[model samples]
Target: MQVKTDFNEKQIQILLIAEKLFAENGFEGTSIRTIAKEADINIAMVSYYFGSKEKLLEALIVYRTSDLKIQMENLSVENLDPIEKIDKLIELYINRIRCNKGIYRILHFEFSSEEMEEKMKILNDVRDRNLKSIETIIHEGQAKGIFRKDVNIPLISPTIMGTFFHFSMNKAYFKKLLKLDTDEAFENYIQTTFKTHIQQTIKALLIYES
Candidate 1:
């Protein structure tokens, strides 16, 4: 996605290589030289673009979520009701997870707690913006008398996110346990059954009670 603007072709190439490397080798394990060599660019070029390996990893996270921000922005202006927007938001995550499972895998598994705070420091702006975007939608629903004011976005956001995340992070075990026959069947389950479950849970959590 959005990944900020004005990135040149070479910068984009290095970022893509860094994403694949970071996903394969964990953040601490990946090196600047490794990315430079893999991308067939000079070490100085990598530094010129991203400064440090840590910064490059931060860029990767930004690159992945750029389009997501765009999608959310688009949805904000649509004529859909707040409830419909919530469903659309849920669909956006599920669909993105289905299509780019590895990106999600990289995001979920690559961060160790010690450096998570540091790395998130780099990503905090994007993270906070996305959270506030969701929170704004919730407040709109509350004003419309559709969503419960008691619902907490911080808890509810992670709940919705974690449901998909936990499942994806352990999808192999989940598929085997559920006796799914093939990858296609497993994907179908996620897109339909799991997606529906997530939608229902969010709806239940936010629905105004009498």
Candidate 2:
């Protein structure tokens, strides 16, 4: 089943609460009752909205990631050059992950569990769609003779995502090492220093050397 696009106020509220709880306590640890209580709704309401915890988790993934498709579609049609499109893609990815770290963490957890193959299918499908979008950008650059011909297009996403994931996973250590005093300071570093670094790295990969 696809993720529902239109969520009412209450459904969105429940989804947000479920996302937070799943990220904090995990699917096994977070019960329907806990979600209901956290959302200040009854368990029946939770059941009515999502039949089970698994369904809720699936819905959460859909709710969180469904917008990426639309965003990517919009970016593809923009009047920007391929390089500028790539830069915008980086910015979009970074901002999206920064805002929804919790849901991503849950996705990571679900990905590693064999019992969650159905959920994994949903996540993998979304990933493939996103990768195709990224590939389109790279192909556009290649067609224009801007990007190198021998580029390993598949590795590009991991390079961008892996670097950010590594930093975020160890953000506390990095923050202390960088002498950042507050969350705002660290985030500023990410949006500026880290983002530019990703853009530079990708440009280096895609650009041909004379």
User: Could you say which candidate leads in lDDT?
Assistant: 2
Root-mean-square deviation of every model: 2.7, 1.6
What are the per-residue Cα lDDT tens digits for candidate 2 across 1-210? 665667788989999998888889887789999999999999999899878788777777788888988998788778889999999999999999899999987776646767676545677778888888888888889999999989898888788878988998898999999998999999999999999999999999999887
For each candidate in the order shown, give its overall lDDT on alpha carbons.
0.79, 0.86
lDDT of 2 at 31: 92
Cα miss at 44, model 2 (Å)?
A: 1.9
Residue 13, model 2: lDDT of: 98
* Least well predicted 10-residue stretch by lDDT in candidate 1: 1-10
What would the TM-scores of all predictions be?
Answer: 0.88, 0.92
- Mark the regions of model 2 whose C-alpha exceeds 4 Å error after superposition: none
